[model samples]
Target: MITFESVTKRYPGGTVAVDALDLEVPDGRTMVLVGPSGCGKTTSLRMINRLIEPSEGRILLDGRDISQTEASELRRGIGYVIQQTGLFPHRTIVDNIATVPLLKGWPKAKARDRARELMDLVGLDPAMARRYPYQLSGGQQQRVGVARALAADPPVLLMDEPFSAVDPIVRATLQDELIRLQAELRKTVVLVTHDVEEAIKVGDQVAVFYPNGKIAQIDTPQRLLGDPADDYVENFLGFDRGIRRLAFFPADGLDLQAGIVLGDGTTVEQARRAAKQAGESWVLLTDAGRLPRGWAALSDLESRDGREMLAQMPLAPYGHTFRVGKDSLRAALDATVLSRTGLAVGVDDQGRVVGVTSYERLRAAIQAAEEAADGQGARPS
Candidate 1:
């Protein structure tokens, strides 16, 4: 929805904040600008709303030149969020959030009602509407800032290091909130950050800027992590890019072993014999409906006499597990790491024992992805 066509920004002292740049932010998708300080990431963002006019080339918003649009009118339709939140200290949270709607000439009551709805939408307590910004926590204030920016339901949003001022945990929470909000609202968002990790986490497309306001590369997070454009891009991705690549690799492809299953009412001797025949130390105990109850070890069954029930023997507690359909390899890895056997037990959506994935399988999947990436890199572009 926003396009920068050979845009450049220069100061009176001959300092070029932004070099001749051509970039596009597709409709309803987030594009992140990431680099170190003085790279003009923030300058590029402000130019979209005409907060900083470009010196050399024109910027287009929805096919029309922003230079022709009035500044106030243009800003009203474009949401702007900064690091400090910039809320009025004297105004209540609701009043602050309603600022944009009020500026757009909505009735006072209607604007405040809209503000309350936004507050709830951003996961804030509606009762806190009457409270001042100072009365709320730092995270709460950031939420209010987000509510304020989104109050008028603008088609485009500009966020300049909005999460940088907060602590790490709160920043993570805000990042997750932004992702959730983007999935629902799909606003054309351009977020500026020096943190490459944050950009990867939140951006649909990331623009890696160089020292002179030049773009190193602009691509999806998966592509950026899997294949950087140059050494500069690779250096920015850090040494852990391989681990980050796991975020994109699906868990469905991993080989899962068929689990040993036993009937709920089966005798201990019967269950033990079945487990031995299957070359498994433990057997998954299931009810008539095929729902997994727990795991029973063969040793537990051997100690139990016929007088004692199979359920009486100690059952190995099930650790972290995931549904077979989920795309998360991280959860599966977590399960393997926490389990004594270094294997993740995969259960169906109905809670039935489907199979188990060992650490070896997980390692092989990662190796395959890395090899695929290397092969792609070897080819000419």
Candidate 2:
């Protein structure tokens, strides 16, 4: 556990960057510090590794005061990742990752072996091991940086705006990668970011900072969105707080219409009957494996007289699907909007369609989730 007891960072001119701030980062959980420019989020992160020493008070790792340890030795024992990667230009990817282990007097071959293991762990190609930093893309470089940080298997990891340098698509991929890594590694993490959405997506606990080096609120992402502590934190979350809150609610319990689901080999009459039973204008047709094929209109099925298969007719696109029980309500909502038939396809992990949910059902689920959250909030802490 990392505990900051009345930690303050005051400059020579008496400009306090962090004013008597007290925060606790539980072991093996992620804590994200977020705010606008000059909010001292980065200042607080740097102070953890003694990069920027506090003016007063104590910063303790576990039970020991960090000030008693030599700054270089303390940093070597902790993992640090920055936005620009900071890889040595001339070194190979494997060599870059092996820096810390080699510095700590591990054998050259053992350090390189550990580096190779970490490369695969972070989803880098084994072929890229011999490549230089300049040869890889921005996203790949960031992965290498992550691999290097975890090279020594440090207990705590500090990251500052780690994914900010990439494009939106790459940034999202990196964010997901970080979440997956955290789940597997369970390192004590302190991340500093200016993006609130990123903070919500990755943090187990989020600390929203004021401009005066003070925390406005620190809470879980769900609670932070459902109930903002003040106007500053509320405004920081923006107008999409309600939508963002849906991320916490699972989509598994939604009432899906399975009656309108038909096999590709189904007869025209069967499709019409299924659609009528489900009170839907269209029927979803699936292949023999239960994978979504497309949507077949009931009117089109009715035009055919015989026992013709629904597969004979032209079908509309099914848009996208969300993993039921695995994805959040927000993902289901996105699928609903993108669908051509105004229904979200819920699928299993194998991408086989299980059922379909309508917008009305999703709306009801959201209301129920909000009501439950409100009920919980009314009770004493």
User: What TM-score do all the candidates reach, one by one?
Assistant: 0.86, 0.91
Which prediction has the highest lDDT against the true structure?
2
10 residues in a row with least lDDT, candidate 1 = 372-381
Which model scores highest in TM-score? 2
Point out where model 2 deviates above 4 Å: 298-309, 372-381
Q: Give lDDT tens digits, candidate 2, residues 91-205.
A: 9999999999998999999999999999999999999989999999999999999999999999999999999999999999999999999999999999999999999999999
**Model 1: residues with Cα > 4 Å off, grouped in runs:** 261-317, 348-352, 363-381
Model 1 RMSD to the real structure?
3.4
How many clashing pairs does model 1 include? 0
C-alpha lDDT of candidate 2 relative to the true structure: 0.92
* Residue 271 lDDT (model 1): 77
| lDDT by residue (tens digit), candidate 1, 238-303 | 998867767766677677766466657777877777778867677777678876667777777777
Instruction: Write out the backbone clash pairs for model 2.
Output: none
The clash numbers for all candidates, in the given order, read 0, 0
